[model samples]
Target: MIRSAYSHPVAEVEITELSAVPLNVVELLSKAHHPKAGAVVLFSGEVRNNNNGKEVAYLDYEAHQIMAAKMIRTILDDANKKWPLNIAIAQHRTGKVTVGETAVVVITASAHRSEAYQANQYIIDRIKHEALIWKCEYFTDGSHQWGGNCSCH
Candidate 1:
């Protein structure tokens, strides 16, 4: 499914909602694939219809595009330092996202599953925490709320 090849080991950072999350899982996997890589982990964050019992209509995301990419790259660098990863990628979508649509994707490849899984988790957690991205949840009942803090909910 990889339509094209990538030259970099890390392919993270994107801000757009123009054509859906055009990220090809196969392509991401292939990008991380290596002769020595034994595991590849991928995470997809999708928009849901409900949040905490509220009927959700859609999610609107905004980001300081340049800052977001910079922060994401920094997170990836930290992950690389922590794990023996072959390749890793993280991408987020901006603009309006509807139910069942993917809002973000993260992939990690390593020599073992443990490293790949942990790195993937670290990358996502950092992106959510450090990136300058904001999300607004619009409810079906004609209301909306901004969320992006470290809210436990």
Candidate 2:
């Protein structure tokens, strides 16, 4: 279903467990933010259980607040410049998150699905590779390893 046009711009930043998200991401972008929006792509990053056959018990993410925020904003800005994204929001979780919890959410709105998909992938990749964030993977054996570094076993 298409959303009604949104006239007033909405807030676009949050970084806590109780943070408010644009519940109507697709609608907000299509009807309110960009009247010409035809495609909307949303992605969420959740804590996973399997990593190299080892069951992950939990995850603790740490970040250099100042730098991480700056980097995330930079990623959004870069994506907007490179693509036809009308409204984009990308957020991550910090502190501790249990398995299956949503850790990150990225939404991209564009006139075409290509832009939406490309920008969505670009944002996720850039944040993981360039942002000042670190993830500690807690395994079933009570051992931990740093992630966000190649994502390879």
Q: Write the per-residue lDDT of candidate 1 for residues 1-153, one digit (tens) a residue.
A: 111124434433332212234445565456656666788898988888988789999998888877777777677777877787777777788889888887788888878899999999988887777788888999999989889223633
lDDT of each residue in 3-70, candidate 2, tens digit only: 11233332243332122232333433343245666777888788888787889998888888778877
Error of 2 at 90 (Å): 0.3
Off by over 4 Å in 2: 1-34
Clashes of each: 0, 3
For each candidate, what TM-score against the reference? Answer: 0.82, 0.77
Model 2 residue 16 CA deviation (Å) reads: 7.7
Model 2 residue 107 CA deviation (Å) reads: 0.7
Q: Give the TM-score of candidate 1.
A: 0.82
Off by over 4 Å in 1: 1-22, 148-153
**Model 1 error, position 45 (Å):** 0.7
The model with the greatest lDDT is 1
